[model samples]
Target: MQTDAANPSLKKTLGAWHLWGIAVGLVISGEYFGWSYGWATAGTLGFFITTVIVALMYTSFIFSFTELTTAIPHAGGPFAYARRAFGPSGGFVAGAATLVEFVFAPPAIAMAIGAYLNVQFPELNPKTAAVGAYLLFMTLNILGVQLAATFELFVTVLAIFELLVFIGVVSPGFSLANFSAGGWAGSDTFGLPAFTGIIAAIPFAIWFFLAIEGAAMAAEEAKDPKRTIPVAYIAGILTLVVLAFGVMIFAGAAGDWTKLSNINDPLPQAMKFIVGENSGWLHMLVWIGLFGLIASFHGIIMGYSRQIYAQARAGYLPPSLAKINPSFRTPHRAIIAGGVVGIAAIYSDELITFGGQTLTANIVTMSVFGAIVMYIMSMASLFKLRRSEPALARPFKAPLYPLFPGLALAIAVLCLLTMVYFNPQVASLFLGFMLLGYAYFWLTHKQREAAPDDALLQTARSLVD
Candidate 1:
């Protein structure tokens, strides 16, 4: 049997421009909406507090994270690092957590897409529109990586421009009084409730920075990952940080920050303050916002499919998932497989009611929970790999070393604890998902070849030669 890497394999066609597209494309939606949910928990100033802390964490995390990504440069991202540092079991856990993050994220973005469409066409059911969005994007992804990335680039550029437009339009209307309108949530003032609100807001704060790490997942597809990954990752996270803070401040001040706090389309709502509800600019924001969501939705599907391909190629998943399209040079089977799971999760409550909770509510919790796990594991792996493989020919090194990664690890652990405490039911659900992942690993993942990491790394080396 010719190995998967040798047959119908990934093509390294992505450069710094394309890599930046994938990086920003995978996370640009954060600027449009989702992050505002922190306001519901922490209020405007309180959410700002959460955003600042989470931003620091992602900053430290990304800087330290590039070191691992450049050194290993595998499609599995965090899994590749953990596997190198820990072994088969650790690798399996990291990969599974990654699947959780990538797999569920699309459906959440799909929900947003549906909501965005419903605003324009009130007759359309959100769920129906969501499923259609999935089919459209997945088909585009399966057709070719270059085409999909080109589309990603187009939409990401448009999305960023619209965001800048939003800031400019809202600047005159921005008010310090409105920004601090609801400084802290709940009936109780500054006490345990305020502190807990900040803690509870962690996941929503994370929504701003969620899948930025996903750029690293495209290591296998980057033209020159050693030079490209660090550039894209660093520049990408910084862009998002500025966007996150900018959008939050402008949106909060433009209108009733309370009303715009947590919704599918906060930008439209906030823009209403300046442009009026029926104005052309407000409508423009609504339509363009759909593209923003699509950018991340489409980009992350590409991210997850690569991860699915990597896991299957290594025998952690069924072999069929490793099938690459001979013409497109993309993992066609993995793309379809992940799309099916996303569609299923879209209607999971309808398929089998899980406590009557919406799929986005239940599923996004898992994605965030899983993202935190990958962060902690990846950062820890950074430290371990440094100690264990001091001479492992690293092309890019983290700027602050122990300080950068240590801040990342500590903040990640804090967020994980906050997520569990505030979201007990969903946290329980995440634990259940982990158990299922463990069961799959125990039954079929023993007898490792110890060659996949070396093989995956060699795939990166091949890009240069």
Candidate 2:
């Protein structure tokens, strides 16, 4: 098999801290927005319960997933783990899911970004601002990985600080009565309707910690895979868990949480209720809250591009996407390809609506569907690898053996079923996208075989072996 020397590889400059930034930054936008939709369905109390369940699921999932990431240390992340445990077809499923999660997520964030900007400058078209965000971030990614990562780290720190500020500013006016009123989907008690509302709210709860696993995609670029990845994943998830709960509870308690539901700028609206419409804190949130959106948007752009490049190099996608820019040592083609898809999704906001939901809500649910699937595959891969490759080098074993991964897998399956039952239209769209991608992989597998000596293809073989 051709060695890695022959394949175009990413530059290695990322350390534990940088990986932490990527991990948290990829999902930080969840705290700022996209999660309030749960309130529309589950009410404040019910959504809080949902968030707690989802947080536990993520905590376990991240711990178990760290084992696979440290061992494989590939750009494909979960795709590599599943490919080694199952086969090429397994890789395709994981890759497609990861692509969907990463690609579809940004358009939602971009639209949120547009909404935030529009709050300040009413004349600015939100769609135009969304597209501009795409262009600016894509250029930053194409410039280089280190530069992009550094920028992500900077913005992520700013975003975290901004969330703290939001929590503090809103704390003074927080009223438990305001939060608990109609908290159980406005029902008098936790009846059947409230129970089903919690089930229906699963996807929005997932939006809070959706893309934390994207950090694993940077394994190939990390300075030390085993050690650095664990630190990043652990610290990243902990930080996000604190911020997610703090922001959610404090924002919900600030005033009548019901009005914040169904809006993209929930933080600003929450602050406006606490303070006044013209309060400086509210204005600050509209402006500084953008760092949260930008962090996730930029970080996920890094993630999806690497996933596309890795799969293309392995013959799961078009070969042209695998080519790294000679100067930047980055997957320029892959970055631009994902950007184009995201930009198209941005323009389709009004063109694609379902069940009277806003474009952001629909897109967030779609992305969460992809994420839950990827989590299931990754957890299963972890189990299979343990049984099949008993001697595989595992620098960091899962702390609880079968227990951690088993819980994660179980929660993920339940979440998927609940989401599918609640959002059949979005679920159908997700399934259709997966089936279409699988069909392409099935038809093109043999055709890609004609180029047996391809260096990148050989590298893929060596890595899988």
Give model 2 RMSD, 1 decimal. Answer: 2.5
The per-residue C-alpha lDDT of model 2 at residue 416 equals 94
Model 2 earns a TM-score of 0.95
TM-score of each: 0.94, 0.95
Over 1-465, each residue of candidate 1 has an lDDT whose tens digit, in order, gives 233645766777888878888889898887776777778878988788888999999999998998888888888888878887898788888889889999988998998899888888999999999999999999999999888888998999899999999999899998989899768974454546578778888888888888989988788778878999888888899889999899999899887888876577888888888888689888888888788999999999999998998888777788778778887888989999999999988887754225434456556667899999999999989899889878776778888788999999999999999899878888887888899988887877543453244456564354332
Off by over 4 Å in 2: 1-7, 186-193, 447-465
Model 1 worst lDDT window (10 residues)? 446-455
Error of 1 at 326 (Å): 0.9
lDDT score for candidate 2 against the true structure: 0.89
On a 0 to 1 TM-score scale, where does candidate 1 land against the true structure?
A: 0.94
CA shift of 405, model 1, Å: 0.2
